[model samples]
Target chain A: MEHLLPLAAALPLVAAALLPAVAWRRPDAAWGWAVAVGAGLLGIVGLLLRRLLQDGPFSYAVGGWAPPWGIELRFDALSAFSLGIALVGVAVLVFSGRYAQAAVPPQRRAWYYSLLLVNLGGLVGFACAADLFNLFVCMELVSVSSYALVAAGGGRIAALAAFKYLVAGAVSSLLVLFAVGILHALTGSLNMADVALRLADVEARGPVLLALGALTAGFMVKAALFPLHLWLPDAHASAPSPVSAVLSALVVKLGVLGLARVLPLFAGLDWLVLAPLHEGLAWLGAIAIVAGALAALLQEDLKLMLAYSTVSNIGYIVLGLGLATPLAMTGGLVHVFYHALIKATLFLAAGAIIHQAGFRTLRDLRGVGRAMPWTGVALSLGVLAIVGLPPTAGFLGKWYLLLGALEAGRPGFAVALLAGALLIFVYYLRILNAFYFRAPLREQILAVREAPLSMLLPVMALALLCLLGGLFGSGPVALAALAAARLAGGG
Target chain B: MRRLLTALALAIVGAVMLAGLAGLPRPGDPAAPVHTHVAAHIVAHGVEDTGSRNLVTAVLLAYRAYDTFGEVVVIFAALAAVMVVLAPAAAPPPGKTAPPPSPAPAVAPSPVVGFVIRLLAPFIAAFAALVLWHGEALPGGGFQAGVILGALLVLLSVVMGRGLEQPLVPAAAARWLQAAGPLAFAAAMLIGLAGAGAVLGLPAEPAWGRHAVLLLLELGIGLGGAAIILGLYLQMRGH
Candidate 1:
């Protein structure tokens, strides 16, 4: 069980390698293998959660090496919580196995699954990495795999989207690497703890600040923070549904987590200078929330609408982090988890709809709810969550975030949060209205069948969890609070 | 074509000017005198810091490993992008099919060019190996070694038809090798971590372990570099 932590990271990676080889021989088996791997990851994450709850934190030295000298695999509450979110997201993505088989050509399916698995492995490795170099390598693993996955959609637009994503991702990676190099130069260490320990005596504020700026800028780009989010809509909209699910759900969270890692490192810096950065970030997040929702409302294409919604939701996470209260941090962390589930479910349901109907525009989806009831219900639940309605995880995250903002005496941010929530309601309700109220545009609605159980099961499971997460929010909230505390340099 | 040549010429001249401003020194003999302050500083300080005999290896492997990593990733990103862009939209045509033959008249390889490539291949390989092995004690290291390997392959591709070379270095294999190199470097860092308590943060070790770790890391770099260059070549050939 203790060893399962490393296995959680290794399993998907090993599976990725094995997938291409075996997939050529047995195409049918590939989906099954991917689902099985997803299930295994869920199980591993569950075990890790149990262990984390029982123990304080877990550390594994890969190949039995010590820290600052060897690669250390650390699993504290923060990592375990993030890993859980990733696992849930992966499980939702596995729902696409059926949709993919039905929609995509057979030959492309194997590479798609391989990229997803590789992305999963990279993220898991990122969550557990205690070394800076390992983090960068894992980040690249995730980035390159994501770019390929985005391009795998097999369209001219998809290729262009991939190119945009590649360029942005490369620039972000270079910035991150530059920061890591500076950190190494300043501290003569590549280990996170070692760097932290060494920075106590370093008076070279200029370079340190530069490194922080670079890291922040790079991560903001990756996280699609407002003005730096140019590449995101195209990449997300043009990507296949499963890839969209994973990208919006888990990949962006990696950037947020990177920010979390860097925040503690710079805690000792002058708050006056840092205050502006946070204020700007908060403003960006608020604007993004409004801008993303407005943009989403204007979109005819369902996928593009969802992509903008992602940008908006990311704003909530960053806004909460910017608020800098314990409660806000908790909200941010919990949003990372809740958003993964909600977004993945919605994306999966959307994929299912697209697979069955071959329609992508919201107007084209009129009366789809009647045609595919289960998918409709799952999608509706996902919408409710995103809209921050009751008895769903989405509401609880916003509730905490808004409360944190108020508690921090930033009524302006509180208003922004409320406005963002209202905008989400407007857009999400539009989706629901289009699905349920509008007349059927296609005559084939009578013959339309439900998505395969493989797809429906994961969506329903996630939707149910979303409800359960809101109702039983205390457990995760407490865990996230603890994790946030740890991240804030608490014991 | 004329405009393009003029633009290229202007770009080269501008680059040279910028390099001059940066006080860039000319590539020279190892034992030759370096008159410039920067060159002298590099020669004097680089050996102690990097423990390499080849000044180029010293700078690449240690002083500027971060830039080297970026260069490697750029090549890798290019390869990945090409594969994604060019992967068949439908099932690939079956059999070991060649691209439709070019209509251009065949020009015989220059006798001098053939002789030069044949002459340089072994010497280049030997020099690359020397650079890699003596990286800690000299200026040349993994990056230079990799460049040399790429240059050799380019020579081969020029002398031989792309079709013949394509079989020897398949695109897929190049992709794998490209991926494997960074993975290998990462693995070595992980291995080094086993002794030091952190990945890539190797301890002041049992002298042997330190050397072993560096060698392994360099090997990963070489493997990744060679594969990436090969992948690029294949892509450029539109294989």
Candidate 2:
């Protein structure tokens, strides 16, 4: 079981490598293989999570070399995020069956599934990576695959958007690699724990601060936080829908998780003050909240609206992290988990509707809810969840964050949170209004049918999880609080 | 003025980074933490522990083998990425299993140039084999040998012209070979588990088990890298 740690990530990757060859004779076999691999991953992660719950936290030294010498994969509170990765990975892969069949070119389907698995494997590997260099490697795996996935559906806009994303992603990746090199040179260790321990003894603050700055900037761009989010909307909007779900739900969250992982490295230094950094993060996060929501409100394209909303929701998570209290961090972490579920549901449902009706804009999609009632209900549920209505997944994160703000004696931040939520509510209401209430701007919308079972099942399943995640929210909140405690405790 | 501001910003960033780097311990100073800590241990035990005479291979294949596995996947992913974006456009029409027709070269290579390439190819192949075979004792390793082999294939493709679009390797075989890096790692992992009790741990009883695993990895990386490089070249050359 302990050896199963590496297998959690490796299984998907090896399966992915085999996918194209396996599907070569029968192209459609790719979907089944991918979904099986995804389910296998989910099972592996489940067992690991169970072990994590039984034991406190565990570490696996790769190739039997003890850490500070060889790479380590730690299944700590932070790594529990692999569960979310696996869960959403399975959902997204299942959703991709019909979605890819329709949207992706027939010749590209196997490669598309292959890229998706690599992306999931990278995300899982990243969450469990206890070595800085391993994190960088896993990140590259995710980043490269993501860029290609955007263009996998191949149109001029997708290609252009992918190129733009590639540039931004490359810059961020370079920054991260530079910082990793600097840290390695500074401390002579690539292991995160070893680096942190050695960093405490180092006298020079200059290099440490530089590495921290680089790491923060790099991860912020990866997270698509605020001003750095310029590449996200176009890339997300232009991508095939299932790819959009994976990107918006899981990929961007790695950036925030990266921040959480690295912030502890600097926590022990006496000369370094993280307060100014936190203050800046808080301010940027607040502004992003308002700005992203406002941008979402302005978008007429349905997927583009969801993409901008992703930017705004990321603001909520970042703001929680910025507040820098255990409660605030818990809020942030919980949101990270719940938001993955909510956003995946939203994107997949939107994909189904668009795939069915062949119209993408709000006006064009008007009354689509009435036509495709089941998918519309799921989308509406997603809308409610995203808007933070009570007893829904989205509400808990924002609620905890608002309380965290007041707990930290920051009423201003609390007000900003409310204002952002209100803005989000307004945009989401527009989606509901267009989707359900308004007369069809296009007459053909009335004739559109519900999405096929393959597409519909995954969307409905995710939407149910979105509701259950809130109803059974205490379990995740408790786990998040535990993670927050560990984070708040200085390394 | 905007350009000036851009330059100014870059200069500022460069200066700060330089200042930070200057604070680093001087390179090759034995007193530096890099030299004294993990590096010291690797230098001491790497050979004995891993059974590779080349300490570089020892570290790469033994102590930090998992990272090597990741790197292999990264290379594989690179190929996967290229294929996903470009393969569809370059693919043969549906229901056709035959290779896509390559547009004829505008000017055929000079027979003398072609002859020279063909003449040099065998030696290049031998050199690649030597690099891979001697990786345990020499500076050259799988990636280096891979680049050599990949370059050889590309050179041959250029000279061979029309018939070479399918290249030396068949399409079906090329797919498997392109995955050789990761597939080899997976094989090594299972072998290690059976023989050594750890996921990538080389066995102690056989004494040759470690060597076999290392050689297998080298071949995988070398062959896999060559295939992927060729695939990228062919795909990007377009239909």
Candidate 1's C-alpha runs over 4 A off are A1-44, A60-73, A99-109, A270-273, A487-491, B1-81, B93-154, B164-166, B169-225
lDDT of 2 by residue, A1-491 (tens): 89888888888888888788889888989999999999999999999999998987899987788888888999988888898898889989998998887788777889899989999999999999999999999999899999999999889999999999999999999999999998988888999999999999998778898899999999999999999999999999999999999999999998999999999899989889898998889888999999999999999999999999999989999999899888888999999999999999999999999999999999999999999999998998898899898899888889899999999999999999999999999999999988878999999998999999989998998899887778899978988888888778865
> For residues B98-186, could you state the per-residue lDDT of candidate 1 as single tens digits?
44432321676888888888888899888878877776666656666777877777677767655423444764555456655445545
Best by DockQ: 2
Alpha-carbon runs more than 4 Å astray in model 2: B90-100, B162-165
- Measured against the true two-chain complex, the DockQ scores of the candidates, in the order shown, are 0.11, 0.69
lDDT of 1 by residue, A41-131 (tens): 7778777878888887888765343455345677876786555555565565567677776645565676677667767877887887677
Chain A TM-scores for all candidates read 0.96, 0.99
Reference-based lDDT, each prediction: 0.73, 0.90
| Model 2 chain B lDDT-worst window of ten | B161-170
Clashes of each: 32, 0
Each candidate structure's TM-score, on Cα atoms with residue i matched to residue i, is 0.80, 0.98
iRMSD per prediction, in order: 9.2, 1.5
